[model samples]
Target: MKVSTHTCPVCGFDQLKEAPRSKSGSASFEICPACGFQFGVSDDDDGLTYDEWREDWITRGMEWSSRGIKTPRGWKPEALLKSVLKKKK
Candidate 1:
């Protein structure tokens, strides 16, 4: 049997890792260690582009924040770096 691998579109990295399966059994995501980009295992199933995905992810966080959920202070720097790099695109 042949094995398939997913590549990162942002940095052209071939070392993609599979994310844990969700309870819904929806399509799985492949994460790029180099650029921290994630997408569905199959392109056809992944309707959102990188930016779209990021926006949705951010919106989810915002929703949680609105509910008074607190985020860790240490994560702020990494989130800022990701945002800055995203704007460079």
Candidate 2:
């Protein structure tokens, strides 16, 4: 698969301007619009593993997470999730 820098490592939403983690291993602190995973806050502060969050998000019905941002037309989370990097972290 062609990995993208803009892709969300957990949820495969590919619209981000930057990767979740930087080369220096700093979390971007950006919250994903698709799955609501805050790169730093969710992972570091909350102690929530990426895979655990993804699994729970999937179990709870994949819904658009961003409140201010409108969901894209024809949003299909399961389909987009196919591009997400699996539980490697």
All candidates: CA RMSD in angstroms?
10.2, 3.9
Best model number under lDDT: 2
lDDT of 2 at 38: 94
lDDT of 2 by residue, 1-89 (tens): 95555878778888886789999999999999999999999999999997899999999898899998999998889877876654343
* Global fold similarity of model 2 (TM-score): 0.86
Candidate 2, residue 82: how far the Cα is off, in Å: 1.3
Relative to the unseen true structure, what is the C-alpha lDDT of residue 77 in candidate 2, on a scale of 0 to 100?
A: 90
Off by over 4 Å in 1: 1-29, 32-37, 40-44, 62-73, 81-89
Q: Local distance difference test, per candidate?
A: 0.44, 0.86
